[model samples]
Target: MCFLAESKINRIVFLSTVTDSFPKRHKGPSLTSPQRPTMRLASGHVAVQLHGEELTKIQKDFKGFGKGLVRLTPGGWLLPAPYTKFADKIYNTEFRASDVVIMTYPKCGTTWTQEVVWTMRNNPNFNHPKAGIPVKARSPFVDSDMLAHLGKDVLNSELLELVKDIVPHPDPDEGLALQLTANIPDPRTIKTHLPFSLMTPNLLDTAKVIYVARNPKDVVLSFHHHSRLMKSMSYVGSLDQYVDYFINDQLIYGPYWEHLREAWPRRDHPNMHFVFYEDMKADPMAELRKLNQFLGTDLTEEQLEKIAHYTSFEEMKRRDDFYREKEMQRLDQEVSKKDGGFFRKGEAGSWKGHLTDTQEAKINAWTKDNSQKLGITFRYSL
Candidate 1:
């Protein structure tokens, strides 16, 4: 069975924590009900404060991140409150020197990059039966436990069958994804949306890290669609509203510029390989060659060409049935059929079609304010 198809069995969980004292000003809908007590995330010494103004500004129909967002103090990185549950595991995991870690804020060409890296590292021939396994299974997402805290019952029938025989973890706090990732032998390809501050301190020195960044404009659009399909997010907000969340740094794994900035300064580190989504889209073969060099995969030119074609947007879409989780298919069948399903239009600068002039200007201003000092620029169009 493809790990992509099997691993998704437990991937659809999402639940919110109730807060004892919510300032009346910020109370919003809970994940499952309307007008429930405001949700908040608390773990150990840190308690996230609900900003009334931010919550009130949210459209009434919004159901995902609006319920609650937590900021890890000192670093000020934002994530869903439940992240606290698995924070220690994520920050303290033992990384190996042979591991290849792919880091990105969500939807920033992560799947594409994962497919490319996994292909080069594991199955350059495209003939290996293991190569047919989904990238998710081959390169596990470490933060997956955070998304699956709600429990096993929420998973659809297909997923239930896949995970039925797996023994329950002895440590309640240890995430399934983290466990799977830890046991994946040597040269594992690990994926995470967590910023550097949240990962294990020695990660940079211990493992090869590939950081992929996309223009904030396109990230906002792709993330909007992702939220709608993820079930946990259940986002129904308009593109304009989503833009407000993006610019204000309220979305899960947001503060987009900050995420990139964390890696930008370290781009030259021997173990760090920084890539731009636009550059990859423009010239995948060149990017693949560069990646091949960084990974020291030593793929033949023929192998690189084959890997490039296999991971192309059109090809991935051709095999979307294997790529999509059952939950995604059930959440919104129309969305799955309308575009390329989870494999949506893989183009840069498509934000032009969805963002209004005001939204675009606001995002541009937000980008400047956050990224001016980083000395990095993005290509919003091809």
Candidate 2:
């Protein structure tokens, strides 16, 4: 079967880590009716029924971390099991001339770049209501739930309703990238964490792609915090252990060096533009102007200034809070009052505080060695 068609098959069952601690001898009570009960893997969560071989296959394909399992795709990338099928589907999707793809490894400056690019592309007037609506809705992550949830809550907010004319809201029911492109208007802005090799060839050929790179030390630190924040991939491992996994390329969507090495040669591709996260942090306005030139958005100096102000780290954090609060209310989930919200510290070199001297040296050596192997050079710090 074609990979795309195979992706539609729901053969794999995903059971959360909470289900893994059931007593060995106790098969547990059935989940359904007294007469015809179904055996459950755990309490509270629904049981996933799978054949013996299917269960074996899933176990073989997934690597366990603390309390979560990261599914390993045939291509060797790790992802949450629920998203593996979606990731496979993304590789088969096509792209358009007007599409702008923000590609990066996770926890890089993906959200920041998304904000900058979306603002430059859509809000040329510099007066779009910058509050309430989530940045995910503005520039949907095409391979994730962001596309389906793009405008689901916009109609609830009168403030967001004003920019419906500016930002094309995608249908909530539309989950596939192909369907999303068909429905949403031109100049579609999308985000993805897939490495360059995994992305669709047509997308690379047609759409303009903005590749964002971050110092690996910062990427590892930010990713550790992010993993703990996300429920699906809850990680309780030590920073040392995490760094080991990071160095060994065992973390989800990592092997960071290889992801960069593959993308660096293509930096000069007509449709690909490389932007460093630290550079954006150093001077966002200059980066925005360069991005504007690349995208052909041609925003005036006044508009650029306005966009720079509104999308500044502080402003974006405030907006993110508004969006997160709304989501908490909508989902009826308790919010964790943590220091690292979605938009964590936007400073460069913050990794120095978190990484040990040994860890820093290891990262530096690995980065230097890999860059040389790939015939590319990178500045380690801002």
Top lDDT: which candidate number? Answer: 1
Each prediction's Cα lDDT score? 0.70, 0.61
TM-score of each: 0.81, 0.72
Q: Cα RMSDs of all predictions?
A: 7.8, 10.3
Shift in Å, residue 271, candidate 2: 1.0
**Residue-by-residue lDDT tens digits, candidate 1, 1-382:** 1111212223322223322332222223223322332222222223343445555454253454443555544334556655655666566688988889999999888988988898898778876555655566667788876666533333233332333333244233456677667666566898999888778778999999999999999999998887776555667778787888777666777667768867999999999999999999999999999999999999999999999999999987676566465455335666556644577888999998788899999988878866787898999998
Kindly list the per-residue Cα lDDT of model 2 for residues 253-372, writing each as its tens digit: 755766786578889989899999888888888888899889998888888988889889999988787766654423213224655566678878888777899988888877777767
Q: Which ten contiguous residues of candidate 2 have the minimum total lDDT? A: 36-45
lDDT of 2: 0.61
Pairs in steric clash, model 1 = none
Give the Cα-based TM-score of candidate 1 against the true structure. Answer: 0.81
Report the number of backbone clashes for model 1. 0
